[model samples]
Target: MAPTIPGFDYQRVQVADGIALNTAVGGSGSPIVLLHGFPQTHLMWRHVAAALAADHTVICPDLRGYGASDKPADPDGVSYAKRTMAADVVALARALGHERFALAGHDRGALVAMRAGLDHPAAITLLACLDVLPTLDMWQVLRGTSATVGFHLYLMAQPPGLPEQLIAAAPDAFFGHFLDIWSQRPEAITPDVRAAYLDACRAAVPSIVADYRASAGIDVAHDQADRDAGNQLRMPVTVLQQDWGALLGFDARALWSAWAPDLAHTTVNCGHFMAEEAPEQITAELRKLMAR
Candidate 1:
């Protein structure tokens, strides 16, 4: 039940990594890649990407493991690190023939984009992070009562077999729980949309688990290495987040500025799923970020 959106051409482009990325392209101008968050696909960017396509060539692709992309086996022999995921974006943009482009991502995608900016600074002209904090700082802030808000962090962080076993036993309940709690306007996610999302989650359980599991282990090592190297985004950064003060009890803007020196942070009264909940606001921020 994908929404019948007008003027989008579904496409698949093969990158150097031997994975063909399933992407949707629309509009016509400078390329701006849009990456989706956890438990969602490029469909999450359908509204915002379509809106931006009026002027900018918007590229919405499912990240490697999540949607219609190749879900290769996760052996430690191959890297499942977000750094490698970031490199996938680099390879993807290069494969699409864009040398320098504007990039943006939400939730888990934001983490990948952040790594892209730090790792491949010259390749990105602008960066936008929607509704996420740095992984390391986020872990630090998850102490005391605030920790309860992100119980899934620990749930997904556990060693392999147990989490996968439990979550697979009740995939809908596991994914649906987040879809239910994360949105301020859960009503925005109609039955059809919810069903589609749950279906994608159920299909990609091991990859999804591996992605989060990396965040808990390998990704943390990467973040700490960057921190040790005194690295930062080093580009104009825009952050849009729902005010989580009542829930997480941390100042979003203050924490963000520490990582991004040239930053513009705005708090929107949306849910954790801000892109779908407030597409207009998110688009406005993207336009402004591009103009900056």
Candidate 2:
């Protein structure tokens, strides 16, 4: 059985043609949509969702190609692009009767949230991105030895066939690598949760690869066009990330400032899986963002 968020109801929401996102809706008051990251599902928001349920309607959804969402194999990688995924999120929120909502995302979901903020500024009142840089800056910072930490990004960005075959061969190990190496508190992700993520990734190998591949190709083009056009996220934005800037020798705040005019960027003292390793802090920061 899939892990359930307390007091939340699960449903499959069709955001695009033949593409439905498996979503969890709970709480009341102002709506806030939370998007989960790679190799995981909405179950990752269990703790934070319950905490925010007291005053906010929390909508947690698996990205279109992850978790229980429909996995469409688009060879061109267009279907899984963050822009399309962002549209899915907006449609999902609108389908739930929310024309405007606060948005928050972690890891891969952060990429989606960023695009949504850029593309549908009217729909997202406030945006919070956790543990990821913008797509363009992300690729820019990855060079030489730094790229080593992001081997999976390059691997999946390949011509498709090989990454799917290799990951499919040992899905658990491939997916579990992030769970093991990225978490400050691995125990926060119980065995059942780990198994659930692995199972989801195993079943959606092609779609997952296509999603990442799009990042290196079409997603970059979209982001670059936005940059060249001087298009920015015209909303109050908050970003929470580990202090990787110190290690990577780049100015995180300076990078984000170009995209968000109204920005609050902070480096958290947690692992990449901040939502799990430090739920209390993540919850507090999100609540603060929504309040703003």
lDDT of each: 0.85, 0.92
Predicted structure with the largest lDDT when compared to the true one: 2
Q: Candidate 1 lDDT, tens digit per residue, 12-72?
A: 8775456777888888999899998978888888789889999998888888888787776
Show the colliding residue pairs in model 1: none
Whole-structure CA lDDT of model 1 = 0.85
Query: How close is every model to the real structure, measured as TM-score?
Result: 0.95, 0.98
lDDT (Cα, 0-100) at 161 in candidate 2: 87
After superposition, which runs of candidate 1 have C-alpha atoms over 4 Å from their true positions?
Answer: 1-5
Worst 10 residues of 2 by lDDT: 68-77
Off by over 4 Å in 2: none
Count of clashes, each model: 0, 0
- Candidate closest to the true structure, highest TM-score: 2
Q: State model 2's lDDT.
A: 0.92
